[model samples]
Target: MLPASTFVLGGAASGKSEWAEKFIESYDLPMIYLATGQIFDDEVAAKVAKHKNRRDGRWETIEEPLDLAPALASLSEKQAVLIDCATMWLTNHMMQDSDLSTEQDALIEALTACRAPWVIVSNEVGQGIVPENALARQFREAQGRLNIALAQQAGLVVQVVAGLPQSLKGRLP
Candidate 1:
């Protein structure tokens, strides 16, 4: 059985979202795709289109760059939601100079209180070489901390690599 909440982590271009989509599709629910990235450039737009094409008409798409907590809270418990990428959400917040701790608190709270079965995707950014720049280091640290917190609260935690999903905390659906 799928848990009330799941945390999916992977590196860039990994099959995290693909795995997530298939995982949730098994639940046989009309799922909501909460996209956090914006199409600000041609490259980004192309990527977004690819993802959209994958989900195509199967999901109710919600475009939210920031304020994930509020967007998540707005949905009914009956609506299954897959937050495609938390990295983007965090980046948006960071770009706006939002208080990270406070935003993370809100996110965790929302996830805990979410009545619907939900899944969130995030990048595992700390596994590679340390960044030389201070800002990059800070971002890496923040992402690591946030992922830890989310994993702790999640009913299931999975890390995908090379299109393979390795369950870290719970069984697959």
Candidate 2:
């Protein structure tokens, strides 16, 4: 069967990444951990380090805080890539005032063109209270729109709540 692309959605600290990791481990292939968070402070750095410590060294780790399209396009068909989180990737792009439409288009194209399976983890940001600031509101709106688009293209979409996963689109492995 052809490899599938999955989108895992959840709130912060909702265990989406953990769930995605378990799913990737089941494939028994050369795994790739695509981390999109850039450590801007000690707290963020520690969190990133924790994630790295949890993964098996056998998996190749790619840290692309922004411009993930090129990195995704370079992978081989024998690999299974797990993007730890898309929220941070979006944050990285937005912080730099990057071209949102162009970046997202590139990302979607790269994901569709990937030869191997991929598990993408992202935050479900639309369920919370509305942001007080304009920038924060814009970010939430953009994230929500991006999630909707990704879900539509994904072969499988899973949602996590309080560490519990519920398959929303396709069958679970």
Candidate 3:
């Protein structure tokens, strides 16, 4: 397998996104930022804006809340793609009652087939207490399963904690 597929997983406020951003910056190729967030309120909008500002304006922005496979497929070998937080995308799919299995299959297929490097960021939501509601529990379980699947496919897997990155599977670039 090519060394282009990397997975970054961490808890909330764990600096995973920043780490991924810096890693992508090291590569001198054109970047595509695949944002999975939807601005539903001021707080979310502010958070999204902060991320946007962190990125160089030269990077192409693609706000895809779901259906990321097609976007990934459109990328070329010379471009690098940074998927900011797959957790939000999963949440969006869960909220819409979308089929998780189908989406995951499509994502894995795209990731495996893509020639360009992909830095996928996702929150590790299974480290905390058990959720109270059924929906929350389901989401947590789905996220865990998704992370596991992605990690298996990834050539490298890094878990960020307290702004420090711990390489779990492969060497850090």
Candidate 4:
């Protein structure tokens, strides 16, 4: 059986989403792909397309960039959810000038109270050099804080480096 919640942390292109997808697919539950990324340009559109092409028809995809509470609350124990990224979710909120603390708290509560098992993908932004600009630095700090909160709420925390998962908290199921 899968844990109630899993946090998959990694750098860009580290295969965290692919690993998490396989992890949840192993349980054979109906899958819900909670996509948080939004495409603003052709490059981003292509990236999104690439991810979409990866999952077969076994997945039901939901595109909600700002509010996820409603989608998450609609889940049942017969299903499993993959929040394909917390980074994009955070970016969406930040772009709209939403209050970070309030939104973060709501997300955490929704994840923990969810009936279905969930795996959340997030970027580990603190390991790199400090961002030079104010906005970039702010985002980096917020992402770091969000990762910490997610790690605390998750039963299993895996850090992916070069596409390999290393358990930093609970054992992988």
lDDT of 4 by residue, 26-143 (tens): 8699999999999999999999999889899999999999899999999998999999899999999999999999999999989978999899999999988988899999999999
In candidate 2, how many Å is residue 65 off?
0.9
Instruction: Give the Cα error of residue 20 in candidate 1, in Å.
Output: 0.6
**Model 1: how far residue 153 lies from native, Å:** 1.3
Cα-lDDT of candidate 4: 0.94
What local lDDT score does residue 27 receive in model 2, on the 0 to 100 scale?
A: 78
Model 2, clash count? 0
Clashes of each: 0, 0, 0, 0
lDDT of each: 0.89, 0.88, 0.90, 0.94
Best by TM-score: 4
Tens-digit per-residue lDDT, 61-162, candidate 1: 989888777777877767789998889988888999999999999989988877778999999999999999998998999999999998999989999999
Candidate 1 CA-lDDT value = 0.89
Candidates by lDDT, descending order? 4, 3, 1, 2
Model 2: residues with Cα > 4 Å off, grouped in runs: 1-3
- Residues 1-173, model 3: lDDT tens digits: 33588899999988999989888877778989999999999999999988988887768999999989889989998999999878999999988889999988888898988878999999998878999999999999999999999999998999999989998998886
Reference-based lDDT, residue 56, model 4 = 97
**RMSD in Å for all candidates:** 1.0, 1.3, 1.5, 0.7
Q: How does each model score on TM-score?
A: 0.96, 0.96, 0.96, 0.98
Q: Comparing candidate 1 with candidate 2, which one achieves the higher lDDT?
A: 1
